[model samples]
Target chain A: MTIGLYAPGASALHRLPAGVKLGALVAASLALFAIPSTIVALAAVPVAFAVYLSTGLGLNRLILELRGPALLLCFVFVFHALAGSVEEGIAAVARFAALILLASAVTLTTPVSEMAALVERLLGPLEPLGVNPAKVGLAIALAIRFVPMIAEEYRQIREAQAARGLDRNLLALVVPLIIRTLKAADDLADAIEARGIET
Target chain B: MTRDVSTRDIVYIALFAALMAAVNLVPPIQVAFLPVPITAATLAVMLAGCLIGAKRGGLAILLFVLLVALGLPLLAGGRGGLSVFFGPTAGFILSWPVGAYVTGWLTEKNWPRMNAVWFFIFSVIGGIGVVYLIGIPWLALVAKLSLFDAAKGSLIFVPGDLVKAIAAAAIAETVRRAYPLMQAAR
Candidate 1:
């Protein structure tokens, strides 16, 4: 449920360079998907779990992060079992769960700013192509920062609607939510301009 | 084709991205009669496309996807990360930007003159039509099912999506009327 998956610690994974962690994730994901063996995929799951355990966030945070994916994994397994073969089902679920756990591990260890820096570095080559990687990185940072704010706003709107007994009205709920959100966006735009971010 | 992205535009994109993420915080509406669960996040995506024009709308969704790929639990029910890209729902997730783009493009065509009917038509075309076009095939491939079967499986989403489209159209019209700045440039 937490947006910022980074868990503070002095673990080796936390110490790994953001770029390296990202690169490893890409490589590992590719490798997992490229190899179609069920046994290898199943083996990767424990390896991923072990790496996640090494983060020292304990099982609670891991489970919280994994809860949604676990539901999805069930659907995948069921679908594959019903529509495909048993081997295929295991292979698909294992590969998916393994990749998810590994990714969550990386996120749990790496801070968002580091990730943004990595993104900026990766996009550096595109400067000549007229791409502003800083802008992209800033956008990502802003999104992460504002996600909780928006979530809060949604809650506030819901509460307001409920107070007025208009909660059941879809239009009553959606209209004000959009209007208020857009108003918030306008204020944010003013704030950004005041700070002199490139137009 | 090149336009300067103002700080305002960047803020809009970020906020819309946040808005999409926030929509997920709300529990999904479950229909007692139907086995499928309907999420409001997709409606936020459609509303975003209609609110901002195509380029900005698409960028908003793109930024959201990038955050998701980087392992932010922003998707519905706090789901995120690269593993989502490999799942059966990957098609729908990946089609988000294209769907937003198409919806925004259609909405922009009639701009100031657009009414509820136009909004409804454009929203459904972009939200339901474009998303389904790519999503169904991707579902079939990832789920290893026949195209027809994939389409059949997707039917459960239709009633909910149509309702969202209608809501989007009405909301778009209201915003366009209430705030002139929200309207497309003629």
Candidate 2:
């Protein structure tokens, strides 16, 4: 459950530019959907797994990333079976699973900063249309920084709820969490302004 | 629009994006009788728009989605990366920014009044209506399920999502009264 985790490695995939990795992902996704052959789709799954292994992150890491999506994959498969298109079900699951694995491989290897830079570069042409690549970069940096802070804040909220013996339902926790988040945002925004940071 | 993005606005946007991440990571709540646990991640998306208003709300969500694509495990249960975009719920996930935009746009219309009823309706329109509009097609056309089948499959989540929409409305009402953002919300 790590965010923007870049597993350092000297593999070929790791050395590839973030833009290329993303571009290839788009192309690969398109091909997966466009080709109707179940065989090719099924074949792609293992190929994706092999590439994931090449990252040297181990089988456990690949499984860890795919754990969330695999349940949905199982659902789609069941849906297809119920609809009497078991073949399509297998193909659909294979297609998605392959894509997830391949993408995780690319993301696991690429640095978050590199990916942010790629987005800024991609948005470079839009500067004339009033897009600020610099601001986008800044926002990305700030979000990355805030992720852990927000997580910590949630921990405190949970602790407070437990102390009060409040029912730890979504509603009970979310309201207080939102209030505090906005409060933090207010102070952080002021601190940023006081520091004289440009937009 | 770009020129108006001050450092303060950027911080709000970034923090909401972080809020989405934080909510996604929070353990899904298990209502005793429900068959499955409900997640607050999507609820956070709804709350983002209602609390921050349209422009910042929309940008906050878009920024969060982009970070997920950058391979951060910021999604629920620590899921992240470009792989998420290829899932069955990809359409719903991708539609979040627009959903937040619509929700924020509606919530800001009667600003300072804190009308919980109207706020609830607006949240439903943006959170449920807009999301289903985009998500259904992704499942029906791209994923090769029948429109009815896809729609039927999605019905299971509607009740829970409605609850989140209601929560968003109530939260907006409370925040307006308690904190007030201390400025023109929009």
Q: Which 10 successive residues of model 2 chain A have the least lDDT summed? A: A166-175
Q: Clash pairs of candidate 1? A: A199-B5, A199-B6
**Tens-digit lDDT track of model 2 for B105-133:** 87777565757887788788888999999
TM per candidate, chain B? 0.85, 0.88
Q: Estimate, for each residue in B20-122, the C-alpha lDDT of model 1 and write its tens digit.
A: 7776756654433323343455676687788887888888988888787776766766677665776667888888888888988987776867888888888
The prediction achieving the highest TM-score against the true structure is 2
**CAPRI category for model 2:** medium
Q: Could you estimate the TM-score for every candidate?
A: 0.85, 0.90
Cα lDDT tens digits for candidate 2, A1-199 = 2456688889999988898888998998999999999999999999988988888888778778777887877777877888999999898889988888888888889988898899989989999999999999989988888888887888788778778876455555667777788888889877878888766
The model with the greatest lDDT is 2
Q: Show where candidate 1 strays beyond 4 Å.
A: A1-3, A148-152, A187-199, B1-3, B26-39, B142-149, B181-186
Candidate with top DockQ is 2
